[model samples]
Target: MTEFILPSNANDLNFRHRLPDKRLAPWVQCLWSMGRPGHLTESRTEKFYPDAGASLSIKLTSPHPIITLCFNKTTLIETLDTTAPCLGIRFKAAGTHCLLGLLPEAFTDTHYRLDNELEPLGLQGLIPVVERLYQSDSQQGLRLLETWLLHRLESQPPANSRITKIVQAIGALQLPPQQLGATLGFTRRTLERKLKREVGVTPGQLVAYARLNRARHGLLATTLPLTEIALQCGYYDQAHFTHAFQSLAYETPAAYRKRKLSQIYKA
Candidate 1:
């Protein structure tokens, strides 16, 4: 699981990640809790880049709601005005459709209010649990949600093995799409359709996301120069890397690094 915590740098914000229960492990990636104190003097904004899958979240704030969010195709910028407690269930690459009963393509680059989508499917039982989440502690809320998922999974189909394989190959090998398609015994066209349906993005977009994801990790963990980081992440040059990074991250790599470091020092 991926956990993001900047306690020392930004005490107002905290995020926790937990492993999925064994029964739901094949379809779920992780369970997460994130939020900030409502009394903060200044607001915050977070930028989320494209990833491999989607999530169902309970947002505890004004216009309180539960929603299903598809993996982003471009950058997603979220502005926080008050205390925002969020609990999320991240789905595996090919898992959301079985639970949500919607094609992954239908969700790309957007979020659907859960009640509006799930009510038609007789999932109204979820509303009470969501209300309890807003009234109880985070752990209790998470446990309730987990239980609901377990019940939901009892009748859901298994994840698509081929889509999982393709995602695994993309993360591990970073091969060109055509070569990856060939390896999977698929033509490029066939592969694109499958990826769009299962992963919410086309092959080329996934590759770019993979490259940027690696660069993001390197930026946070290493002292390497920007040019070196660019090459290591498979970009042709620093200039090209800067363009892509800024497009997705909303800041140049150097600026992002500096801001992070400044936060640590100030803390």
Candidate 2:
């Protein structure tokens, strides 16, 4: 399990440490983990939105059009012309990569400060193929394409103890928003600020997503009962756990497990 929580905006900021599909043990998700603004090629007008952490993103479905990437803490985002989207990958920190053919920067902070053009840093030469897959309306193709893309990234940097500890705590227990803030040794407001910049979600949202993700993995990786799973994930009781599971996953815990079991049996 990773130390940080990845929030998927399109799916209620849903999180999973790994791929849920059984056949794809090595798959990495291809779409934005946070809220997806739109279809891959919908001519997005970004306005300096904040995110959880620095990660790789690619334009897999655009019309092979040139998308611009600019770094401007002191200038305007519109003053720059379109750069090549084929090599559009963002880094959250510096000192991440030494070679420029795969990723653009060695930095991880989202504070953009430099002007980068179309240049592959991690991806060798397979951007357009992803875009073609995206155009075909094949989500499976898109996901499979990312398995190839994620393989090219540098290994995740050594995790910070501060963040890792938080992840571990969440694993052991799930608490309300205020209590969670206190556990982190910060006010809810402060926790919210740091999470938005570094963690990419509020403490409450992270807890919710992390809990749901745990239950998801438990359903696939084991055959634990709903009550047992609920207690293991730190829910107060089965009722509360069921409420949370349904709120986030759009299905009751038992129904979800049944669906999974059904899929496996059918296969």
Candidate 3:
């Protein structure tokens, strides 16, 4: 997985992130918090890339806090409310199934209230504790959250080893979708079904997500030419890369890179 980095304008908001405890590292990606800064007078937008993962978010600023699970199979752009303080737990690819025993396919590309969803799994008890911590100290809260996750992990069944292997293989981008199934000893149909149930995407979609993720990292982290970044991330050429990125991100690569650079310079 790519290292998590806050946006260039993160300092303007109350944003923080913590790595998951070692015991929970395989399933949990990172814990994060975001709040509107008191001095800020306007709302902002947050751009989410396609990561083949899900996030459990709690709107702590609400009168009655509610937990929402957002599963992203494609890019999402959402406006942030200036009055809401939120906490999030991002799950690794296929990690929701391992940790929560929920099929991700049911929640892909949308958000849903998790109250009813978790109750069926006997995990509704966790909601109150999450709310309590959000109202407390950040450091202590994160520690407590990790402790809770560890205890919850103990009660869950062992994660499917095949899913773990599949996630790793997809991230590595070592083979095409067709070859990936044969390499893993699964027929194409079986691979599609398995990935959809476990990861909320087909093998082809997951591979595309992985490639785009690598390309995004390259755009933000290095000064390499577009063609180099495209080729490195498995695209056929620069045109192919730009088209795919624009289709999902709603902006061309040059525009994204320029906008981000402008933000950093202004910051």
Candidate 4:
């Protein structure tokens, strides 16, 4: 299940669920959480869901790529990490009109295929729909939500957790491929192949993305020195770290810290 932590019940923007589980599909969802002034605790299982364009939408707008997230379930359920809390704007399963007003294949049902590399669905796809909903009464909001999400989740099985586990393991690593592969109980080649099969990226690429995400958080949340941050995040040195950051985040670490993050303490 997708977990959401509501800081206050009295708050108007309470996000309970977005509905349906795709490999990670809620292509375009929305929530006030992105602009939240404070920080929130998200465990590793629900660690920050990082994508090339994971969002922070303030206004309702166009649909974006949907992501379906499933929880990790194992033989030893107690041992496997289970729940994660988050808040975001997201797409409703099979909400045809909500996703760019496009009809399904007209013959087929699904929008994305195994090899479909979707471009980012942006805010414009959602605003009109949301604005219309907002202008209506509270019952209308619930009606809109029901119309979008309640229709199909019952018919579909939830996504498997294997993909989530693979992603979590890869993202957890702070070492090179051989070392990380060993930690994940697979050979280097096997790890690479499986990761690509499940996640559409190589193990090394996943790690690189993960490393940049970790650095972004640290640079924003802590006053830790660059050298210390670099070492902790698995860089051979600050130079390599900076190079990777530039490639991944499109800015030098220092610049991102100063320009993008004025003060981002955890919630």
Candidate 5:
């Protein structure tokens, strides 16, 4: 997932992310942190792009920590107000189901406190660990979290190879949605049902996410023109790209590019 931080407030915020260790790479996407660079004085709003995954967020607060599970099918805009830093673990597309045994569809488009949710799975023990994680520095906390996730992975049954392969293919945008069933030796209907049950999205939706992810990076990371980025990302033209981007992101490509670029200039 990409975090869009406007330049005006960038200096006041401390945001960092890093990939997980190789052992946890298949399930964990990345670990992230957000907080004030100095004393926390005000709130900050951030925009998060859709990445077809779920995240576990831990906010360091008074008395006790605040923990939540966030899973969204579209862009998420949120404001943060905390004295201490917030930590998060972003799970891969099917990772929440593979590791936590939670149905992705149930948590779609919303966030919930994990206290009650984890109790049912006998994972309430994780609450304390999460609190400790918030207290630890980024390196120590990420290592501790990875160790726990590695242990959990050892106990859980292996993820379905076919589903994993399908997700990889879709994420890479190598397989067309229509050909997914044929390539995997399942009927289209069966494929759709299984994917939705496990991945929380249809194959087509996954493709859209993959394309958007690429286009988003292009707009933010490079100086490419919209027409060039649209064609490179497999859209027919700039208009198609703009419509698709706006439908999922609530902002047109040109607007998004301009806003992000303006931030860079001001920075």
Candidate 6:
């Protein structure tokens, strides 16, 4: 885990993100946590967008915390009631298969409890960390998690570096599925199978996420016209861009931009 940072808006939730250490960088993308404990008068629900990889999340305030293997989904509405805080270890696109000996596709659009799954996989000892986390600070909890993950790395078979590279390439170039196979020197079917097994989404889905992510960055960081942003992000037209953006973001690009700017002003 990383240092927690609260959002500037007093009414908003807290979100902290930290990059993994060098040794864990290949398998782990980053660690993140979010919460709204102080504002628990009414339950708050948030929409979470899809990303490129899988995440292992723990509901911190739960009495019996269960580690969940969460796969990327279309759009998810997460509600905070008694469990107002949560922490997650986000893995690289291929890290799930390498670390857990499981196909990412099985967990797509869903989550699985790791308690029952890890025991049979000889990973029962790692389950105790959840209980330990109840007594530890964020830094300590993250340390424990990394230690366990490193141990798992030592015991399990190595992850496929080639698949990792392919994922990285897709992100970097924002290549569409139809074009990705030719660039990566793999057939479409082979790429699809490997990504389904390791990354939990098809190449087309990954490309869509990449495009939307690019559009988001452009919206927040630059004053480019929506038309230009849409074209640059590979959308056929403004309508197409707006539809895709709203699907993932739950807001129009203009609205998202206004909200982001408002947050900046508040900060």
lDDT of 5 by residue, 1-267 (tens): 333333235465666677887776766788777673245657877676676788888777666777788875678988765467777788878877877777787664577887556788657657667867755886677777777777777887656767777777777777686686678688889888888988788888888888898898899888889999999988999999999999998999988889877877787
Name the top TM-score candidate: 3
lDDT, candidate 4, equals 0.44
TM-score, predicted candidate 1 vs. hidden true structure: 0.82
Q: Tell me the TM-score of model 5.
A: 0.89
Worst 10 residues of 3 by lDDT: 34-43
Across 50-130, the per-residue lDDT of candidate 3 in tens digits comes to 878888877665456678888877788876654666677888888788877778876644888876566776676577677
Alpha carbon lDDT at 41, candidate 4: 31
TM-score to native of every candidate shown: 0.82, 0.44, 0.91, 0.47, 0.89, 0.82
Per-residue error (Å), model 6, residue 27: 3.2
The better candidate by TM-score, 2 or 5, is 5
List ranges where model 6 is wrong by over 4 Å.
1-14, 34-42, 81-85, 174-185, 263-267
The residue-level lDDT of candidate 6 at 34 comes to: 61
Best by lDDT: 3
- Per-residue lDDT of candidate 2, residues 206-251 (tens digit): 5665566677767667888888888888778899999987766567
Q: How much is the lDDT of residue 174 in candidate 2?
A: 44
Global lDDT of each candidate: 0.71, 0.44, 0.77, 0.44, 0.76, 0.71
User: What tens digits encode model 4's per-residue C-alpha lDDT throughout 75-168?
Assistant: 1111111122222344322223223322222213221321122233322323344445535433444345444433333434335334344555
- What is the per-residue lDDT of model 6 for residues 150-223, given as tens digits with 9 covering 90 to 100? 88787775657667766766766546665767675778899898787677788877777777777877887799
Kindly report which residue pairs in candidate 5 clash with one another. none
Model 3 spans with C-alpha error above 4 angstroms: 36-41
lDDT of 1 by residue, 37-100 (tens): 3644356776666666667777787666746565656677766433677787877655576555
Among residues 3 or more apart in sequence or in different chains, the pairs in candidate 1 whose N, CA or C atoms overlap within 3 Å are: none
What does the lDDT come to for candidate 6?
Answer: 0.71
Give the residue spans of candidate 2 off by over 4 A: 1-188
